[model samples]
Target: MNKKTDLRVLRTNQSIRKAFYELIQEKGYEAITIQDIADRAMINRNTFYLHYQDKPDLLDRCVEELLEEIKNAIVQCPISMRPFSISTLETVMQTILEHISHNTSYYQAMLVGENKIYLFQSKMEKIIKDKLNEGWTSSQGKSTLKISKELLLEYLVSAFMGVIIWWIKNDLPLPVEEVSSQFSKIVAYGHFKAAGIAVEE
Candidate 1:
């Protein structure tokens, strides 16, 4: 039946992707081949070809699929970004962290080690930057910002990415809410305030 055929196709695609991700972590992306993927997936090279044109195609799809999920989640967050509220940062980050928790292995393979795919990291940062950029407006009526929008955005995105990598690299030490809250606090206040260090008045 056509239904059964579609189900089979779905299962096979899952297998292929799972194999590709595992191999990325174990062997590094540059070292993996279609045959390696097929063997790890327990499928033949022909099956891999049926789903993807080549290894590059498979890698592209894997990155695209994950990034698309992130984009979708970001789009769903209704928080405003201008002025950089703690609640806004927490909400958006919580959404992303929750989503990442569901697929830690894929992220680990793409982001955690020497084997990490820089392309995935770059694309993911771009997604975050684009989302953050969407919330900023020129401070026409408000007080002028001491920092440039570009610089602030860069800091937020880099720090966000660093925390995420640290979270995964350390096996997610803190719960999502706690991590987001801490990150939000540090951003809204200074690190000294977030850490309870008394500032010299």
Candidate 2:
């Protein structure tokens, strides 16, 4: 589409998403409806439907946008910030921590209960797979590595999500950088240990 049309579509989608996010925060996924979103955005139900089939579709789109940005953040590691380094882990954690911190209002609205846990699982699964791929090789054979990788990925993602949820539920009294620094060390180093890789202190 032309630039003007693109901008219009973007603006409309943002309005709808902002409305949905606010309502979800005040209530929950189950309580939200297309009419509520339309009312909040001051748009007609037809306008809302033009962008999304329903509330869940809107949520999926929102989550997809968040994940795409997150993936870019992770993959665009600087040359000085190689993923193998502790400092690199800290950097990655810091980027995500900042995202979470900056969007505290949005997260504070929806990131609790099942929603929080779901976000954690969905976001970390790719990271876990990457880490697994990095450390595993053909020497371990496909079958063994496949099973081990899956199990490890599941465990680490669940553990990381659990920790974050606990921190959030406790009101996030600690500074995010501190919490994320410790998390990077604990998670990345712990993975090194699990994979029998030597850590340089």
Candidate 3:
């Protein structure tokens, strides 16, 4: 497509997405309808359907974009940084923080509503799994289910999600860097144990 055509499509999709997001913030996902999104976007139901198959499809696309942004951030991260290091964790935190910051109202609504929580958590889980896979390669006989690497990564991801939820609920009192540094230390200890780099005294 030509640049103008591409821009128009992007602009239309963004408008529809924004309307849905606003509806979600106001009455939540369960109450939101295609008509509501179309009304808010000043577009007809046909336009909404043209851009997205359904509400869930739109949400899935939104989360996919977020995940892609996260992957890109990690890929662009400095190679000198150690995995699960404080610096590395900050990079992760920065991505989350930026997203939350950018969509504070939307996230706040999601946090307050019961329906969106599962979707948010699942998205976070996928991001963690992707990042863990990026950081570790599997060896022969080392199935992800039975390996310490996977176990530790799962634990760390769970912890990170918990902290993120808490931070968002609490209005993010501390700096993201400070909170993530502490999380990194906790995760680093786990990584050390998993990788046989440290022995318990």
Candidate 4:
């Protein structure tokens, strides 16, 4: 009986999430109401209330689920192995790009629409920053850059977020692997190197 109840709950939540995503795509986040979501999901308003307090709460839950999915993908990628080298970075980018590509429509609705919901982006930044810090701390070799660790993390996170937003906004013109490769190359080789600036290490 407990197992059956859990299954029913899972199905209901999935329905609500699916309905919310569809509504966001059709009417945008700001314009979507709890009643609209309930209607689309074919559930009562009270059922929706039982699952979520309001629209923002529903959005938060959806974003949280996406974050978990991305984290899992990153963990499964070869990038999580060891030795934070250029290859590892490229793999990380590839994993992220693939995840984004897989959920392009949902990401487009949440991130690329005219009324973009920045909360999701902010949450992603937090997740990336935490993971980067963890990886750096646990890696065998530490970076010898003159910059502070915090500053480096901020730079990397900003660059990653910028690339993701750009890719989504442009409707992902280039393939995911190609974009990941280019981004990894740019990061691995500094702008000065690409610009013909000779700086001695």
Better of 1 and 2 by TM-score: 1
TM-score, predicted candidate 4 vs. hidden true structure = 0.77
Clashes (backbone N, CA, C under 3 Å), per candidate, total 0, 0, 0, 0
Model 2, residue pairs in steric clash? none
Off by over 4 Å in 2: 1-8, 78-85, 108-110, 114-120, 126-152, 167-172, 187-201
Model 4 lDDT at residue 41 = 92
Lowest-sum lDDT 10-residue window in model 2: 76-85
lDDT for 64 (candidate 2): 74
Question: lDDT values of the candidates?
Answer: 0.90, 0.65, 0.69, 0.80
True-vs-predicted CA distance for residue 118, candidate 1, Å: 0.4
Model 1 Cα lDDT, one tens digit per residue, 103-170: 99999999999999999999999999887776765223453568887899899999999999999999
Better model by TM-score, 1 or 4? 1
Per residue, candidate 4 scores C-alpha lDDT tens digits across 1-201 of 999999999999988988887888788888998889989999999999999989888888888889899888887544331445777667777788888998887787777766666888888888777766777666666577567878888988898888888998898989988887777777778767855689997
Report the lDDT of model 2 for residue 193: 71
In Å, residue 1's CA in model 2 sits off its true spot by: 13
User: Alpha-carbon error at 113 in model 3, in Å?
Assistant: 3.2
Residue range 61-100, candidate 3, lDDT tens digits: 8777765665665565432222235566667766677667
Candidate 4: stretches off by over 4 Å: 1-15, 25-28, 42-47, 76-84, 140-143, 192-201
| Candidates by lDDT, descending order | 1, 4, 3, 2
